[model samples]
Target: MEQSDFYELNDGAKLPAIGLGTVNIQGAKGVNSVLTAIDAGYRLIDTSTNYMNEGMVGEAIRRSTVPREELIISSKLPGAAHDYDKAITMIQESLYRLGIDYFDKYLIHWPLPMQGKYVEAWQALIDAQKFGLIKTIGVSNFLEEHLEKIIDKTGVTPATNQIERHPYFNNNEVVETNKKLGILTEAWSPFGREINDVIEHETIAKIAKKYDKTPTQVIIRWNLQNDVMPIVKSSSLKHQKANLNVFNFELTQEDIQTIDLLDKGEPGRVEGQHPNEYEEFG
Candidate 1:
């Protein structure tokens, strides 16, 4: 990744602007996809304990031509491990699964707000960072209330917050909130996933036509312009390369606004799983 393609975190660690998301990527296929992504210039690999492929990610790293030190491999803590002790043990277990001494960063996978244990989860991550079990700590799927509660209660701010952002639900409020608090926002399923077809959207397609680029390229470019880094998962090597090719073009302010108008607010959520209501225990 180039210097311009890196976002320095609140804690001063750098992450690639584009990341490889390994949600369903597992086994031999998962390993090959990750290895090829590294070779294709992706430096950030995102997975989760819930994804259950930390071991495969480690194997991919070992097989990669790129040095491990040069890449940022991040995983998340699941909702099931919200208790402080459970969270700590899970972090350590994740490292063992990855076959690594310490993770570059680890995240609390979700707030699971109803359970009221995200604060405990945050405290666990803080202690894990202190114990040198992880280099950085962050959260994912945290809405405004959860974000502030964790930071206010723990007196610590996350380095990043991974959220589901796309044209249909740009999540500008949360993204702006994160920006104000010096937290980087990482977008997951930035294309709106299965519920919406971002690549074929009218405005995006129009923009792509004008630029002589694919809608995929245009959307990625728009994401970069909005300052939201997207973690795009594709098992295909060709798709990986396409995701990283957005750096060459710049989207105009008007183009960005035109795309932003596509936002359908809360209804546009890919799975309608509000962090507040979604409960994934494991």
Candidate 2:
């Protein structure tokens, strides 16, 4: 549980390898969950303006004894508000809502093709960082072309790229590209919502038995070994604490190879239409 056990981002910011993701967290439940996670040694709290729980997220941060310096809070800019100045204004609002003075990492939430302003929006994030309101700026759900566009336009690369990743829908190309660019690949949904249910899958179960851990531990161990930071969401106190217990054990190379076989090639349940073709965000 030492803060030293963190991944150093390409931009020089450090984040706990495992974090508490506040995606579905809401109202009082969200506040309580964040408080509990903080008490259980979680230093990273990931939220988004779109989650509509920043107020509760802010409340939990205020109530916790964890100092702002020790905590690494990250949130994203909504794609719909991608105009440069508007995005800056909205991120300032996000900071206000979270009751924090600055964010550890502020990402362009998604490259919503419908909005058609990601390059301009990315420029705004860079400008925000230069103004010292954000420590690091990055993007989520950006494919190679999108990433290339921003890099080409601004000569600045995202420090990280949050993506839909798990054993099932592992995007190898994205991972490789990000690695070469020094952009960290953060797994938004590390456990495919089915990893726990697949205890009967034999491979995971056997690995679990060998390590004297649960299937969840095996999956997390795999993520760690692969150098991918996994973000997991759980409101349950027991599960929240258990999720971070992954570092105590190690999975063998063979075990990792077997888990790799689970890749389904196709996107998992959360797959979106190609970023260029999809415009659903309003």
Cα lDDT tens digits, model 1, 115-156, are 999999999999999999989899999988888898899899
What overall lDDT, based on C-alpha atoms, would model 1 receive against the true structure?
0.88
lDDT, model 2 = 0.83
Give residue 190's lDDT in candidate 1 (0 to 100): 83
On the 0 to 100 scale, the lDDT of residue 17 in model 1 is 83
Q: Show where candidate 2 strays beyond 4 Å.
A: 1-3, 194-200, 267-274, 277-282
Model 2, 1-282: lDDT tens digits are: 233477788778787878788988999978999999999888888899888888898899889998888888889898678999899899899998888889988899889866689999999999999988999899998999899999999999999898877777677678888988889888877777544444356778888899788877777778778777777788999988888788778777888888888777764434453556556444
In candidate 1, residue 85 scores what lDDT?
Answer: 98
TM-score of each: 0.97, 0.93
TM-score of 1: 0.97
Query: What local lDDT does model 2 show for residue 104?
Result: 89
Off by over 4 Å in 1: 1-4
